[model samples]
Target: MWSMLMRKFRRFPVFSLDKRQWMKNVIHQEVGKGKRVIMFYVDIVKLTEVENRYGDVIAKRVLHIFERILPHVSRQVFEIRGNILAIQKLWGDDFAIYVSFGGDVNEEDCRMLSIHFQEQAEKQLNRQVSFVNREELRVHIGYAAISGQDIVKEMYTSVKRAAHMAKYGITSETYTHVTQFHQVLAEENVTMNFMPIVHLPDGETLGWEALARGPEGSPFATPSMLFRYAEETDTVFRLEHICRKRALEQLRYVKPQQKLFINLDPRAIDDPFLLRGEVFARFEQYGLNPYNIVFEITERHAISNYAVFRKIIEEYRKKGYLIAVDDAGAGYSSLESITEIYPDFIKLDMSLIRNVDVDPIKQALLETIVQFAEKVGCKIIAEGIETGRELETLIEVGVTYGQGYFLGKPDKGMGHASGQAMNFLRTMQEKKASVREEPFLFTPAMSEILAKTITVEKHVKVRRVHEIFEQNQRIESVVVLEEGRPVGLVMRFALYQVLGGQYGIALYYERPVSQIMNANPLIVTKDDKLDEVARRAMTRDAYHLYDVVIITGVEGEYIGIVTVQSLLDKMASIKLEMASSANPLTGLPGNVQIERELNKRIKQQVSQMVIYCDLDRFKWFNDRYGFETGDQIIVRTANLLKEAVMRCGSGDDFIGHIGGDDFILITKAAGADELISFLLEAFPLFFADIYEKRGLGEGAILSMSMAGVCMIPGLYENVEAIAERAAYVKKRAKELPGTVFLDERDCAADETHQTQV
Candidate 1:
């Protein structure tokens, strides 16, 4: 039947192999006759939906409806090639028809023909498929006149450009054209750009997020425009599938072990082809592993059926593919989806991460999310980190991973982190380690307290060393170094004693310093803690206790020297400062001291408890009673906490006061409950005497309300967040008329009333 139709329209042939040659010959013949050919590129827009809903059989029938209607418009037909034909079938629901006319052919005639063909095709297809809606069968037609010198080239370019424009609702008499989503997909004109996701603290590349861009200078060039058009036309699945394949094909540009995060619309989760291991096979074909691929589900729409969606995710997980909830906090349904799916990673929406360093509210929200992630065993990745301050803030809040322009922008290669970011990470890490190791002690290393000492090579003459000591009267010791590393120390008195002997000068003069110098001098690294170095110095032999401690770098390179007296002075000063920072009445640490302790614990990433204790109605007691009695009560309460910590807390436990009736207790998570219980049971006994003396009943006396917040370090930004949350929980405890309350939500506990004791 198709062959007979071709014979009737014998001027043009319809065959897969010769379609291009047929178009070329027809355009040449018409132009050779001095004729103007108007080419119409007709594409069926709803064929994809038809294919998806009814099967290829019904979809082919619909395509034939276009084929039949096109002959009525013009006898010359040409089929477009590539993906437009390969996947769509036959003409792929897209074809071009040319009509040769004289120069007198007008625009009005072309318009009328276009309108008639569209209306007639719709009516005929609808009549044939009575069960389908007429609106479901639609076509887009674009036409351009060809009269240029190179008719084949001009006609092909003009008609293809017009078809692209018409598909996206653009039209013009001029040859200017706009590219659309369908044309882009049909031509496979999209490319993938990758942005690195890095570990914030060290700037190590963890993975890359694949981003898609349409052809350059096209209307759908940008990712936003391309994706919007795809969604509008219901071609998102096809477009995304192609993009994922392209991204995987370029996996050779990335490290094999690094993760590849591909953005996928939630609808893809329901796609049968995608779920049947097609994508898995593609990954394997490209030498990639499913375990390293993270399908970042872009939650632009809510999951209508969570059970089915979860089942699909479970299937992916079983194949070793990880799931990430993208753009978290951008919409209301994101958190709900996260709760339902429990994704392995949650990407914080840029809105929350932008300028977070300057915004306390954002920081608080991030802290809450970090705490939540810890409880759910999920990692939090902060996206759109555009500045160093933002990255620093993310690190401070313990964001597990980060991706932004500041770290590295999206490009087409396996890229490393920015040099600036890596250096900053190293500095921050070193500073953090220093802070954690030192805590309240300022043990100046040998590098910091190095006393000026003359250094000589082991080969230096004894006469020269003696003259050096004689010239510098204050020089108590001389260091002997070979190549930058200290090998021996020579004391001034011992050197003078040796030289004072009758034959000592004759024996040692012009000899190497190694013979006269103490070969095994005390040594310490530049990073050695001052307290530790001091302990080593004191344990040495009494004669060598005052000798200098040699400082060396990591490679055993000589740096400087420190005396025992300097180390003793620094330790005494640090102890004095700590003592002065403690609360005078209770002898417990104050706010400044508490913060230092908290910072140490947080840097170590240890699980600890922050208990905020407030004496309920203590202000009333202070008002009714004298200041002396109030002081006595405060002292007694502090003593009770100290005693309980001694009994139930580890030696590392810390007690502090925020001043007045508020106190803080820092202990291990294991010991926190025990400590809180002890305080609750013991506080009433200590308060009973005060109530009796005031002639007040037990109910009227001020009770202690303790709100405990237990968390691992790095889950919070700073000690302030810990204090603020504990205070909030303390307020909730007071509201509930309970003496003990625990914020057991493991985050910023909101359901405090239910967990009261």
Candidate 2:
């Protein structure tokens, strides 16, 4: 067998009995022509044990089986050892094989051949050697390949080293005995994609988050596998370089204001030769601003050498690059990293935002983060807003920016930035204004719009005042109180653009709020009609009447702002409360209210079917997009869910948002399937444009797969549980490529177990 011959090749030279002189002459001539020679040294350690167990006869038969396949796999096995051929099999289960290759042959071929020989040898042995007691047979192939000019002994040593690697690979289970080792590398391929992060306030997309993917149909189909491959080959640095370059090249299509966020393994900072300039050069090639490329460094790995990392990060920052501490507050020393880096932005971890509305502890922590961000001149991006309730909580906590699936799912092309919601905001403001002749004016006695008056020391930062102004929007004007005396009022607009200007923080730091605060601003009594006060507010000059501040008592104390929009919103709320049955986000009545309405219809014996809605990868969106933008996404999606329900809704129809990104609708059961069909068709195209806008691609193609579960009364208990199950089924639907799923009625169909193609 080749295994026996390989060992002989390592320990002794082989010369043909009758043709030794001729073979030696040929070998010398080949060596003279500069060919490389690899001598394989194989030792069959199990041979003695095999002989002991099955006697020599059965062992010899197993060897004969190996001989049959020897020629079949000889070319590959021989070339893999650098063209070495087995001179002969030897005693004690040892053998010798020699392969030689000229300048024309690649060394890799010999490695491949060696792999094939081992696989065939193992398979042939396993199939034929029953009496040999397979476990007793162990063989090792050692080879050293070197240029003919090198001494044979040196060549032997080199080949032996390679054999060690092969032995290790086998023992460690890096490769199956029957599988070619080369195929392992061939199987792992890396793929990449991107997700958009849109800023809600201005509808300007902020950046794209580069996501890692792997080869389709390959076992290595996720970032984890790609990384594992890199680690295995010690080529992680090479892969990062490639990923960075590819992501930058793709950034050419992004909007100018938008940035490209690429994740960096912080451990890479210790790599002395990592080319930082090469990265910038790629950006230059694509004409992208260095400032627009933000590196999101995750803290999942411990940063062992802080001094080195700090130096490298500082060097990058000096070159107009921005740094963001991703997943802040998620792991060890997250806040410490933020403080150390003084990042331009802090991305709150999604876990902190999940179900935030119901968690008081979470709200307090978030508020603290916001306050700290204000002090440090860093913007806070809350990650993961998936429900209206959560959005409302974030808004109340003074968070201004966020992103999540609730905002918009990542797509392969262009998608819109909720065009309908923007238009709705503009339209509703006007519609409500025109409908009421008296503008639904509210007297102070009926409205509780009082504000708090704060006295600050003269050395307080103007930034602090601005922070207070931004957070409590109800404060129309601030009366700077110093030593119990009113020094001045701070105009809101003056502080607005200041934060974005040069020296903004310095100009406000350590300065009295009075320095920038207006003096003797207009004052109004709390007893005035709120709508009438809003009308008066429009006529005042910028300086003379900073903003009308209403005093709850006499002597012009501080109170909340009374605007026309607020009055209209308040009127709507009153109407909603009087109705006492609607969802706050989409203004639909509560389930109890809905049940009454539904029962009324059912009592009349009207047919109805319930449909559920759930956002797919909504969590991923929140993780990528901060919670602020996520809220906008949730609010918009809630409206869209309502719209979809209404489009198919009848007098017996109902819609609701089940806390987060879950929804339900009850309609005529006969037409319920039709509603699912309509939604399945419309949702993707409706949102694809937004993805394109964010530069994921030309026309955003969302991966928000959806599925609906038909209402089966006995299948679930109560309306809440029914809605929960339907939404759960919808989530399973979203796992597939398309956007729609309806739980099939066939007995053979199970929506939950559907596969994604």
Question: What range of 10 consecutive residues in model 1 has the weakest lDDT sum?
Answer: 80-89
Instruction: List ranges where model 1 is wrong by over 4 Å.
Output: 1-180, 253-257, 270-288, 437-757
lDDT of 1 at 507: 56
Give candidate 2's whole-model lDDT: 0.56
- Report the C-alpha lDDT of model 1 over 20-117, residue by residue, as the tens digit: 56566766776687766766667777788888888889888877766665554343222211001111112577766666666565655665566566
TM-score on alpha carbons, each prediction: 0.42, 0.41
Winning model by TM-score: 1
lDDT of 2 by residue, 1-757 (tens): 9999887555334444454454455556667878756555555446666667778887677666655544444554564435544454544444456667765665455545555666666666576666622573545654445444435444444444444545544434443321222233333334457665645444445677776665566544567766765565445555675567566667667654467777777866533322334554454455444556678777766677667778778665544457878888788789778867778778888899999999999999999998887666666677766665675577568665666666555555534345543453344334433332221111223235544554455457787887777788855555665554444555566555343444445544455554444433444666555445554543332122325353444554444444434545655664555356454554544555545443433343444566656666667667765775456566776555555554554533556545566665667767776667767777766655456555665333444444444544444445555456655666556666656665635212553346431
The per-prediction tally of clashing pairs is: 0, 67
